[model samples]
Target: MTTRTSPATSGFGIEFLGLPGSGKSTLAGHFIASARQSGLALDTVRAAGRRAMRQRLRRSHARFRTLLTFAAGAAFLRSVYPVSKYEIGAYNRFCILHPELAHAALQAMSLHAADPARQDKAGKLWFKHCLRFQLIREEQGDANHVVAPEGFLQKALSLFGYGAEPTLGLETYLKLAPLPAALAVLRLDPTEAARRLTARPRQTPYPLSSMPPDQQFSTLARWAELQERVAADAASRGVTVIDVPSHRESSEGARILLEQIPEDALCSQGRDKRP
Candidate 1:
């Protein structure tokens, strides 16, 4: 008699969900760097802004092609460029200023005027872009891990609007992806997170013609509310949310996270198979 064996499950994966200046990006950088240094093969998925001209050039054949193309290009550029860096910085500098408006602006850009099909295509493109980058690390024979910031989901939702509840697709992706055995939620106090952001070396120019102060304040309030909602939703799921106090040293935090990885999952002789 022949017996059937179940297929091996895919390795564990993780997603960091949080607002901008919430330390998701910074912690992701730290986590990835530590994993690599510890001889673990890791992959990273970064959500970056694509060049405006390239997007416009691709849609050149559409109806009202010339005018629509320019308008779209201008909007895309505005969403990311001179305005983006400044608007983001200003909002961060004074949380009270136009937070809701800023959040709305971000949401608008995320949901650009693309048909459903085109939007789906964009998501695939983003996934492919991340995969391509992962392949680069693969060539180096490093451990494989994928890291993307919280903004990734927010932006995707803004663009795609996955129905009333939202985040359904994000939840599905997490469940389906072959991630790590342990899911770690790197957390820092809000004050500390803000302080680290302020201390960052690079600074962008703030746009003067931005939304009014009251509008900005409303946006900030909304942003806080959104963060609470995301955290609550994520916790309701089975994700292992880890809070690493900012006062604690980075090395200590990294060590705590490293310890969370299952012992069996560690690459023995740097050749462990996927879980």
Candidate 2:
């Protein structure tokens, strides 16, 4: 883990977005490590899921029932928690002030239902849950740096049965989210991403059954779409989008993104107005 001052207070922070195998987390780890060594005030938070599960497991005894209960509690909290309780409270409040944003987000999300590439309704629902989770985290004032995997929207769409059509539309909706101080889209080839994922160090409470073949294919397909979307979106946004090509070394790819962090942006921005 790394520690730094909150960029929110300083009005600085960077968000890294990409697909699962596109190396967002890998790159984020390197960036956080380098930023900390350089003495920058920064904190990293991942969207709730495996990361949240790990956090819960660390605090409680690693019992299956406890984990299940925690998950259920978190989910319930996410939907019912007052908007003010979320980390993305400011953004959510903004949405309330501008209900149109929420409407647009939903519309963008719904457009995916007709997409041809989407086959997994479960995956789409999961993706929506993640989006909500992120919004809630932001509302709660718990997140500063958000590292999103590529094809994040695409994955969500596929999970919900929306295919490529909605997948493309979701890209537009992503831009509507409160803009990060800095946004970096990490790009990589699908083959290279798949290769690296296979070779990368596995971190977790694992079971071969955890990621069965059906799920694996679904995730992989989502990853492929994510790479494509991130590249295109980042280019349009004129954000610091780095393409870590397949031929490049992983360490080198990591270095490319790490180099983009502005020293001033590394500090943590302490608590701000909640939703």
Candidate 3:
């Protein structure tokens, strides 16, 4: 089928979103290879991983000072409740600057320490705050036509860790990043997703590894549901959203994802747009 083409603007960007073990990296690899082979004028840019973010913070005096403050708060949290350095760092990187989210993080930790039953609710609220901040950072970048595999959508899925509902965070992220040229959501069965996650080996014992299979299934399902809702909303706004099945071959999924992107989006018009 011939795909409709939109004018290749300098602002074209696409985000590949999915839960862990949902084939995001595999599909992104296939998509990037195909795009390059087809001579598409697009660059595959991986999301700034946590390590990079930490390195950036370590270098900045202003940010480092803020990190120190967060570290102190985290120390207190550790005294009261078990907390992961990774999560505390995420909160510091994303939520420290924002008052609302900072407060939410404290509240979430407090609840997690005092009321185990309400921990999930508090955590989800904190996740929503962090997700909003992360999405804003994504938009703050100067890159155009970015092939982001693990973008803000990952944060949306992560909200499930804090609570059962992921929609509020997902919705807020959309408001920040709005409609991209393409938003390809990788879909998979919750049970299948859990199986995949279980089989995978981790470098370290993280929270995800410790999560129960039932919780994993529920979280993945919620994430997929939110993706569908976001896709529908994007459609109303004229943004293209391609739903790729996790069961499909990565190559085939890449083709479908590419097809949804306008041909003009692949053309480097005049200037050198290399990043």
Give candidates' CA RMSD values in order: 14.0, 10.2, 9.0
TM-score result, candidate 2: 0.50
Residue 232 of model 1 has an lDDT of 48
Instruction: Give the C-alpha miss distance for residue 143 in model 2, angstroms.
Output: 7.0
Q: Which segments of candidate 2 are over 4 A away from where they belong?
A: 1-12, 46-94, 108-164, 171-175, 192-230, 245-251, 270-275
Q: Which wins on TM-score, candidate 2 or candidate 3?
A: 3
Q: Judged by TM-score relative to the true structure, which candidate is superior, 1 or 2?
A: 2
Kindly list the per-residue Cα lDDT of model 1 for residues 1-275, writing each as its tens digit.
11112121233244554433455555666766787787765444432223222333344435545656666866876876754442233235322332343344333334534345544654445434333333323333322244444323333333323223333344433232233334445443444444444454243111101324454334334444445554444444433445552323555655666666544334432555334
Q: Tens digits of per-residue lDDT for model 3 on 1-275? A: 12323221223367776766778777877887887777655554434333233444455435446667756755775698664454455556665445443453343244322345455554565554444334334433433445666544443444333443333344444444323556788777777777777777582123456567776566667666766666666555556677886735899988887777764344443334322
Cα lDDT of model 2 by residue, 110-197, tens digit:
4544433322434344334444444434443433444443223333323322334545445444454333435556555545545555
Error of 1 at 34 (Å): 2.3
**Candidate number achieving the greatest TM-score relative to the actual structure:** 3
Q: Could you tell me every candidate's TM-score relative to the true structure?
A: 0.44, 0.50, 0.58
- Ranking the candidates on lDDT from highest down gives 3, 2, 1
Cα lDDT of all candidates, in order?
Answer: 0.41, 0.45, 0.54
> Candidate 1 or 3, higher TM-score?
3
From the highest TM-score down, the ranking of the candidates is 3, 2, 1
Q: List the residue pairs that clash in candidate 3.
A: none
